[model samples]
Target: MEEQRVNELKDPSASKKDELLKRRKKQVGGAQGDSSGTASQGEISPEEAAEQAAVMRSQIHLFWGNMLFERSQIECKLGLHDWKKNLDVAVERFKLAGASEADISTVLKNHCSNEEAAAGHEKKVEDPISNVVDKGDN
Candidate 1:
């Protein structure tokens, strides 16, 4: 499965790439140095090129993936903030757009059910000072 393959992927770290580079260098053994692990000489073997290309591609993929993850996370947070800030305006606009009250209520109930449930299930805050005072009195 695609998810399984994704789960198998190791975190992109400098050490893993460094290890690959070290191995490539050992394989090259006195050849023209290529930091990307490709041989700098005129005649590059296809296998060597493919190997180096895969490494470079993976590094690039991880870099972009991290950037995307951070950007998307921030975007989602901002969206949630805007949603909470403008919910009343949004609902009023929906009414002005000729949406039925029943439909609006249904949508709001579904969207805000999580908050209602969370509020209902909130635990009572314990007072440590009260407990300590009671203990001293006892």
Candidate 2:
């Protein structure tokens, strides 16, 4: 009996195909959290919802990039490598970015490196921000 079940699973023409199709139908139909296995009465179609999600994902990516760049600049200015302490300062500068504290911490922990922070400190000490503008005046 077990061997027969295995063979049926391997055969696309078997009743297993119908079962799989029914499961998929249930999942897609109830995606809107309706109890009746149908979309909410006024909910948008699946394709339109997926498109909006994609757009939101891209926007979030851009915002994350901009926030990281600004944080790097501030770290260079402060000549510090301790990003955990400076996160609040960075968050203040990026107040309009709309990122949550948890998201900012996750991004920093994943992407920010000690080497980059060290490089920022080195650049700040060697050149200094004031000297750069002064040099531009010449």
Report every candidate's CA lDDT.
0.52, 0.54
Worst-scoring 10-residue span by lDDT in model 1? 4-13
Q: How accurate is candidate 2 locally (lDDT)?
A: 0.54
Error of 2 at 125 (Å): 24
Model 2 clash number: 0
State the lDDT at 124 in candidate 1: 28
What candidate 2 gets wrong by more than 4 Å, as runs, is: 1-41, 81-138
TM-score of 2: 0.30
Clashing pairs in 1: none
TM for every model, in the order presented, reads 0.38, 0.30
- CA shift of 104, model 1, Å: 37
Backbone collisions counted per model: 0, 0
lDDT over C-alpha atoms for residue 118 of model 1? 55
Return the lDDT, model 2, position 10. 27
Candidate 2's residue-wise lDDT over 54-99, tens digit each?
Answer: 5455445445555655676567567777644455455443343344
